[model samples]
Structure formats: C-alpha cells, structure tokens
Target: METLAFIPSPSAGEIHLGPLPLRGYALCIILGVFVAVWLGGRRWVARGGQAGTVADIAVWAVPFGLVGGRLYHVITDYQLYFGEGRNPVDAVRIWDGGLGIWGAIALGALGAWIGCRRRGIALPAYADAVAPGIVLAQALGRWGNWFNQELYGRPTDLPWALKIDPEHRPVDTPDLATYHPTFLYESLWCVGVALLVIWADRRFRLGHGRAFALYVAGYTVGRFWIEYMRVDDAHHVLGMRLNNWTAIVVFLLAVVYIVVSAKKRPGREEIVEPEAEAEPEPGTDTGGPDSADADAAPEGSSAEGSSSAKEPSEDGPGRGKPSGGKPAGDGGGDGPAGAESVAKGPEPRRKAVDGPAS
Candidate 1:
C-alpha cells in the first residue's frame, strides 16, 4: 500500500513599489473591482437603467463594504491585536489584509439602498442588476487570498492541496505540508453562485427582492461548508463554531424571508392607472382631437356634423348638433330620441327640414 504524500509547494514573487512592495493580492483585488464594476454597469444599462447608475452606486457600496469588513475582522479577532500590544487601529490596517465577508455584504447592501434612494431608482431592480456582478467580484477578489496564503483549510494531500509558505501558514496548520484549498473552493463556489443567479433571472419571473435574497442564501450555503473545514484560528461561540453557525442561521433566515415575502405580497410594478384621471370642463375642450371637436359643435343642429370636428355626447346639455334641433318622427326632445320628434327651432320660418324626408 502507498503511504499518503504531502502536496508540492507553490512559489511567490513580490514586486517593488518605490519604498513599498506590491503583492499579487492587491493587484488581484484592483483587477477584480474594475471588471466587476464594468460588468455591473453594462448589465444595468441593458436592464433599462441609466448608464452611470451602477458606477455611481459603487462609490457608496465600496466604501461602506470596506469599513464594514474591517470592523468585522477587528471585532472577531481582537485577541490578535491585544496579544502584540497593538491598538484597535492596528486591526484596521487594511493594507495588511483583514476583511470579513459577512459585514461587507450587510453594509454593502445598506450602501446600495442609500444609493438607490439618492437617485430615486427602484431598489430591487438595481439590486437584481448588481447581484451577479457582486458574486463574480467576490470570486475574483479571493484570488488575493491565494497570493497572501491565507484562508486555507484542513491539511490534505489529494494532489490539489495548496502549499503555504511557513511564515504565512495558519497557526493550526500541522507543518505547512499542504491543505485543502478552501479559498479556491469558495472562489469557485462564488463563480457558480453568480452563474446560477444570472441563469435563474433569465429563466423565471424573479422580481422584487427575490434575486437579492437568493444571493445571500447561495453565498451562505457555500460559506457553511468552507468555514467548517477551515483550520484558521477564529472565534468560537457556544460549543459550535462562529462563522459556521452564522452561515447556517443566515441561510435559514434568508430562505424564510424570501419565500414568505414573495408569496404574501404583490409586487410593486405600475400595472393600474390611478382613479383620478383628468377631466375636461362641461363647455371647454381638453385639446384631444375628440374633445376639441366636442366644444366646436354648432347649436340648433341635428346630424349636421363636420368631418374635421365631431362633438361628444358627454359634453354640456343643449350643445352640439343635437341641441333642440328639429326632431323628425315623433318626440320633441333634443337628445338622441329627438330624431323622430320633428321639433323645429331656428332653421326656417316654415316647418322646413331637409334630409331624405325624415
């Protein structure tokens, strides 16, 4: 029988930045953000939104997400800072890489809500437009982890395990032999989530906030498994792991909320006209061709209507061609029934009426 073997080590190269060193991590993040924004903006335009709306919303979401992510990282890993006599601000040293995904998403959505309100755009529509791009952006962003050699999982030697450098290795990593590539798994999972969202949107009548909720659900499901396999030292709560529990709870909540809300409430699309429509006055016209013709009818006439203008029956009484005109057969009223009334008024001094002897 063959004994288990460790995975081969991967090499790293850092570029100089004048006085600073530029790592692949930062470049990956930058490239990811650029591509994500470009794709999102294009989608927004295709979905009948303004061209710059997604870009404008990005200004808000990016900052909010960064701050939220930093805060989450610091709050969860405060022990690391106090251990080295470092201040709370040290935890915020984003240049050194510490960001929490959950906090990023929560505050990012908040920022998106604010952006939609600022521009008076439909929040759900914009949310749907950005959903896929956000997932793919996260996928690309995780490549930074591959660079920094962080967020790896339990040790494994199944040919594709990631090899981490000794200095960058997680404290619990047995001896930097190799570990399950949790970052790669999560990144690929994110890519799958993005594709699922895009395809689901095209396939069904998903509307309102369903797409956004699906995003949360899909991401949490992936995070649940990935978080459990992670060997990185992280906070634990109440016998169960923190992030793993978070993934489960958030997934359930999103699922319940989406299902209940979608079934219970009708969507907010503008389907019906309001009750109070415009109404023209009794004697005046509202400038529509029929209304204009309505007010132009001559008095004391019957069926003498003109081709250019015709009066509406709903106009003022004693108006239009039927206004007390000579009724023909029996009744003297000037309404539609007056055609047989033979009631003459101002046409001729005698009982003169012309029109096929009616």
Candidate 2:
C-alpha cells in the first residue's frame, strides 16, 4: 500500500440552515466582497474620501461582476452545458460553481464607473485605493475552489497534496488518491500579491491607476504559472491553455499601462472624491445673514441720506429747504458746522410776498 501524505477535502461544500442551503463557494465569495469593501473604504478615507463610498459603489459592481463572471464561464465552457448529453439548465445554477476573474473585473469596473460618475468621484483614484483589497478578495475567493474539490493539479505524493474523494476524482485518474493543490497554491500566491501591491503603493506613492495596474500585472504573473499547473478541462491554443495566453496578454498590457501612466503622471492624486458644494439656503443666499445685512445696509443708508430733499420737504422741519442749507465740506471744512447742522436738523424756507418780503 502507498503511504498517503495529504490533506483531505471537505466531505461536503454546503450546510443546511433550516431548509436553506448555504454553499461554501458562495460564502467565500461573499466574505471576500465584504473584506474588499471594508479595506477599500478605509483606504479611500485615507485618501480624503467619504466613508461608505466603496460599499455604495459595490452595490452596482457586485451584481454586474457576478453576471459577467457567470457569462464568461458559460461561454468559455459551452460544451459543459450545451453539448450532446449536457443539461442546459445547469448553466443557470450559478451556485454550483464557475466564475471568470477577467470577465468579473472588466464588467465590475464598468459598473464602478457608473457609480463613480453618479457620486462625482475619480475612478482612477478609487481604483488605486481599492487595488490591494481586490487582490486580497481574490485570495480569499480561491478557498472556494478548494471546498468544491476542483482545480487540482497532476497526481502527487507530496505532504501538502490534496486528497480527492473517489466521486470527485477525474474519470481518467480514478486510481490517483492525491494531487497537487493548485487552489491552495493560487490562494497563497494571491496573498503574496496583495501584500506586494500594498507595500509598493506605500513605498512608491503610486497613483493615477498605476497601483491597480501593478496589481493586475502581479496577479496575472501568478495566475500564469498557476494556470499551467491546473489539469482541468479547458480550451487550448498553440498547445497552451487559453487562460495562459490571456494571462500573458493581460500581464503585458498591465505592465505597459504602469509604465505609460508613470511617465504621463508621476504623483499620487491629491483627492479621490469630489468635495460637496455647499448648498444655498432655501430663502437666503450662501453668503450668510451678515453679508445680506452688509449689502442692504449700504443701499438703505445711501438712499435715505441722499433723498433728504424729497422726504424733509414734505414732513420734517426742513419744509422745502434742503438739510444744512449748505453742501458738505463748505467753509469751516465740515468741522463744527457739519456736526451742529446735523444735531439741529434742517433750516426751514421763509414765506415771502410777490416781489419782496412783506
């Protein structure tokens, strides 16, 4: 008998909670999302953004990401659900398994763009703030693959090799008891990538989406190697798995973006979220009551002081004569006379006969 040195897979990947079944795959994905949002929110706040912005944006991103991931998986593995003897209905059962990270990220970014537009936030700045969290989410999500007993590598006798259940074993490899734990390897690699991105972001002060680009590049580098080790059914091109080619292309593109972005803009963004404009009061101006008083005071004082001829002639002691009976700054140079005239009020006009005074 061969000596077995490996970790046993979970008997089942689900738990029943009073007729409601909770799948380990779904739980991992959900937990990863929460962690990502929590970490992203903190980073965003550090960049001078409002709290809960990441969660608000996630409302849109999450659904789009789920749908996109499912669509990519179905499209790429159409034979699994649409070919002869395949059950088409299985495609709708997303809880079972299968999610493409590339598609999820692409569509999720689109959704985030919509959210950022509505919230008046800069997408590039937000992407940088959330990059590390996104990678960590991926790391956490890989555990789901382990739970499902999928994504294993070639048979091996290593101590950390994963023990596959007879029912879950590959049909051609039914005799094999253990295999390389590709899922575990990817999970560990992703953790390392997350840390690297975080450290690089802090050290280089990466911004303008460069940090996110670095994350993509680093993740794809790990994925490229990890994908090579996975022996699952997949489409191949040029004797290589399709994902291997995708990883290579995406990695190169991400690297190019980082280089180009660093050259175009060399510093971190000063602000991530837009500053909310102070709203004007319903029945008042934004300048406040003091400003209103200042504005009206000058107009009211000027009008009252200059219109003395009209009001004083009709009612006050001035009768028809003007106030002081002399313009300001006359002889006496507006000293005592100006003060005395003001205290005594205006001078009245004298009543006179036809030609001369009677």
Local distance difference test, per candidate?
Answer: 0.70, 0.81
Candidate 2: stretches off by over 4 Å: 1-4, 276-358
Between which residue pairs do clashes occur in model 2?
Answer: none
TM-score of 1: 0.70
Estimate TM-scores for all models: 0.70, 0.80
What is the Cα-based lDDT of residue 249 in candidate 2?
95
Report the alpha-carbon TM-score of model 2 versus the true structure: 0.80
| Candidate 1 residue 225 C-alpha distance from true site, Å | 0.5
Q: Taking the tens digit of each residue's C-alpha lDDT, what string does model 1 give over 1-358?
A: 1216544434664557798877766666677677778878886766556667788988888889878887888888888677666676677567667788888888987888898788776677777777888888788878777777778887776677887777877665547557888888999999999888888877764667677778889999999888888887888888667888888888998899778867875453331112212334487655877655545654433223442122223344543344446433323344556553334333421123233333
Candidate 2 worst ten-residue window by lDDT: 347-356
Identify the candidate with maximal TM-score.
2
lDDT of 2 by residue, 83-182 (tens): 7899999998888889999989899899989999989887888899888898888888888887899989988888988998888889988988899899
Q: Report the number of clashing residue pairs per model.
A: 9, 0
